[model samples]
Target: METHDSLLARIAPAPGQCSRTILDPATGTPVGEAPVHTVEDLEAAVAAAAAAQPAWAALGHDARSAALLKAADAVERSAEELARLLSREQGKPLNGPNARFEVGACAAWLRATATTPLDPETVVDDGETRAELHYRPIGVVGAIGPWNWPMMITTWQIAPALRMGNTVVVKPSEYTPLSVLALTAVINEELPEGLLTVISGGPDVGEALASHPAIGKVMFTGSTATGKAIIRSSADTVKRLTLELGGNDAGIVLPDADPKAIAQDLFWGAFINTGQTCAALKRLYVHDSLYDAVCEELAAVAAAMPMGNGLDENNVLGPLQNQQQYDILARLVDAARDAGARILLGGNPDPGQPGNFYPTTLVADIDNNNPLVTEEQFGPALPIIRYTTIDQAIAMANALDVGLGASVWSPDVSAAREVAARLQAGTVWINKHGAVDPRIPFGGAKQSGYGLEFGTEGLKALGQPQIINGWTATQTRATPN
Candidate 1:
């Protein structure tokens, strides 16, 4: 594998920071490099953003909308190259970025942001006094993203901030910087320099950006451990926060469902990107009556799928992103097996292929005490815990602190809807898994993090609503226009 640092020379530049080489996750190769910002760099980026913000916001509806439409066009033009870079950096499998799902969604989102308004409207009216509400941009946003779903996550942060008329300075995880850098370049051609910036590096940079004075809001998506750190740093300014943290999401299979059908849904839910997704179904509770059948079908599917680097379109699973994830997966598998959980399919890393990746793992009879059942595994391992009733299943599923996403499997749409409604997750699917639409609001509840990130609610999350308690045409709107 070529040294990942090799790509440092040609990738792209951060608006006000130094750049670094970003490595490829597939083979530890360097596909390219990106700017790596420092505390000073973060501050500089924020300053630039603050200086440029008012003008961008002043551009208002039409001008901003036109620019964003240009961004959508750029995304469409570079879709293929972007997908290849996304797969190499993020370790998603065959369908990976090729799904074109997030790409198209972003184009639609950016355009939507361009047109949405935050102006004051008359709510209650009388002769001389009137009351109204006004929505305004919050200012410069410091957006920190995770390793999974780089392009989509970037849009989640940027579109809202831009749409609401605030500028953004983003920090992509150290693991997958190239993809973010590639994405920023596409946006750069459409907007001014400081409007959307990307910065890469580790802890120092993240803390630096989060706490910077010029940043008005800090939005983050990553592990719970790091999220705490970021929160602590942002305290000085009390910067507004939006966090989409880790999820040990659960999938419940009702007794009335067909095992084969549920098994298929759970496969993509659990093993997509080799299960590196934040909200990917990590813990599963199958109805006791269908336990054995569900296990059999899931194992057969896992064993049948091809695993390799994502460069080939035929591969269903790709290499894990790095050594740390590899070690974590191995430990989880071993621990589950030791706890007497039945390993029906892939349980360990493939030694024949020397890379940072694992196969789809399905374990049965895993107890709640097991961390694999309680914690967010964030890997390809799926521990199927059996339950007897809907109440028991729901109880077990809601038992974890991370409530990012969940799915209720049943051919019965009515039953699925009922179970899904009761789930304490940000997003829930019925009879289907890992299926997301651009129009639906996405994000998690509780420890998984607060704040919504898509659709209309998501667009609204980026806005500030001001109550016009006492108003005249001129005595009102003390707030800046």
Candidate 2:
């Protein structure tokens, strides 16, 4: 395993700025330090990507795909080492359904993206007229990745851009930049110099990248407020953007769903990654008939699962990645409790604990207006609201301004499919929550931000369409001469 010191060296902060300590969220201890980059450093990285992009684009899909496949191999080889760093920094358990899973996913996504192709299409073909549409790479993609699932999300943003022929300057979330930088180093070994680079810092670096004149596009994953700021910043350049912003994803359980059978799936759906996921089942609306049983079964399942330091292999969950998020969750839970919401399990914070540990909390009987239900907690807490009718449930689910993902749970697949179709989310699942496939496209609808990620549509979003038309020689001569 690479030492924290060695990994720290991989991050490039600006020359004058001091390094910032990265904490192990599992123990609240110092994991390593990441450099705090300045606007100048961000600009330099952008410039380097801009310089390398044309050549990268010239290499075409075959060569770029080959390089990405090699990077995937490196990621697989370093999976163990990267998973440990990921566990410490990102606060996900090292095994089971957490850090290792994310590492494996990173490699899988890279391979999938490497194989996915965007071939030019003939829009029109006749004897005298022929038009072809080509997906051309946009230069210098500034990828600002979020802290939650940093490795996989970063891979989601950059791999496609790189595979589609654009060079990237990535600035990972300050709280979880270590694993990203480390993973970047592994991928960089197979990539050309300046083709992919990492700049570690806070909002300033992100702002600089978003507003920079030379950056052709900005691909961001975070809050809606921040996404809007990026939109405003990118206006001057009219840069292409893919913003996968905040999601208050809702999961509706039909009266027909067997509460006992779906209990485990429901528990993991909401609490996976300690409920830090953007598309995690945040608010659950259950038909009133199954509401109490669903709550009881979900609470039982959640209570049985172990939550502790992420390094322990037996633990399935870990701490919140940072204090800011922890406090936000704490306040929301407190407000819900004060409003007479029944806390089925794990509502309070363990203030004496070394880590930012909030137990897997489930609140029952909360109305749609409850703060916990209304806001995006983005932590290990779920508010289970009871609804009398499917119409009511659907109405409540779509009421939120953000719509990244939603799910319908029922025994009848056909019935579930009917309900799923009405969901306002980008990705709606039946009997499942946040299952994403490389072959399927995923993105937000409404205020959750625009553009798709994953699949062919996602690959196409990283590029611009250029149409070439062939005209008859006689027609051209008559017009010109």
Candidate 3:
């Protein structure tokens, strides 16, 4: 029930603190001021987290789970305010799979992370010896989040770390700090002081957070370049890392797929969040037999989705989050046009537009090696490549150094599974793309990044594993000569 101004005021920086004005991506207007914390601030946060860790871990699993449940309720109570703030700051509309969906996902992941069990397991149990494996708290964890889904990704990083009994210090992206600050404020209502904190600073602060000696682990979701930088910084400390980096995911369409039947799903797969998703389908490969038909169907679906300011309820799609991203998308689309690729729809934008609004573009008859197809556009431009054989499609798909996700679309489930098996991605969807689940483990292969998040595997990643081995009292030990 909080009003927009009241919610913004709650997360505003203190009167004298150094801060930066966050701009609305849909319109070049100030959303709110995010406090610019420095390396000193990061040190204090980490110190506090390190100091608070042992007591939190001693509370045991049930108490922590109960606290997380209350935090989830807190998120629900402030859901509307968080969604509206996210829409303004991140440039995703309130409708569709944008702001509201991201906020709802935050609460869902909290509840899921709270209840998922990780009981001690007896790895080896013979009559003579028994060995059990258990996970212990890693103390302090540092979380670095990206801008595209700021609030939800923050939840993804923090929930498991807290559930595993580690205190977390978050460093949100410079582009979307207000959303994260507001979100953590809501969740912190039910959490103890110093249990969770957000440091909204520049790259220097991020570097400090990753390399700080007090932090035992770091969970990051950002570019491959930043992920590599984090690895180098953490080398001295040998911090445990969970990195979800950049991905130029691909999707393959079999000749048997019905173009009209799957067009809607295909459109959303590539254009979700204006195509800012890390695991979104960027390059699509369709069999030559149905290439033209698939392109036409997808183009028809893309042309109908409304794009405007995020405050507008009817506009499901919004502007690119920043001008740099908009320029990257425009340059790639223009290069495709110069290469004589067929533009099925939307390759141009009005220069007079107020915000960074690039049109939804679909390029067909494009070569597999074209930059738009080869590189990660990270926008609402999809390059469709045609292939005569499944092997050729699979080869192009696997050729990329980064493989986070991919999909195979076919009417026959069995056939789709066969094609999917040949893909080198971390997750291969049979008839869809980027349908991440809280219960299923998600990560990347190759240069896309390392480690896993979500489910039981995710919980284990946040903690340190220990083995307890002992001999049974009934067993008699033999003497060695």
Candidate structures ordered by TM-score, highest first: 3, 2, 1
Cα lDDT, all candidates = 0.78, 0.90, 0.94
User: Worst lDDT window (10 residues) for model 2?
Assistant: 472-481
**lDDT per residue (tens digit) for residues 1-481 in model 1:** 2222323333666466565665555677776656666677667778889999999989875677788888988877776666666777776653643324445656767766665544567888875577887767888998998877777888878987887788999898887888777777778889987888776767898888888877878889988888888789999998888888988888898888888866766788888767878878888888888899999998988888887777678876777777888888788889989989888888866676656777678888889779778767777789988888899889888887778889988878897899999999988888766676556778888888888876666666776777777766655445776
Runs in model 1 lying further than 4 Å from the true structure: 1-21, 94-105, 115-122, 126-129, 471-481
What are the per-residue Cα lDDT tens digits for candidate 3 across 265-319?
Answer: 9999999999999999999999999999999999999999999999899998999
Candidate 2, position 110, lDDT: 96
* Index of the highest-TM-score prediction: 3
Candidate with more favorable, higher TM-score: 2 or 3: 3
lDDT by residue for model 2 over 71-175, one digit each (tens)?
999898888888888998998998767999999999999999999868889988776777899898888889999998999999998899999889999989988
Q: Model 1 scores what on Cα lDDT?
A: 0.78
Which order, best to worst by lDDT? 3, 2, 1
The predictions' CA RMSDs to the true structure, in order, are 4.2, 1.8, 1.1
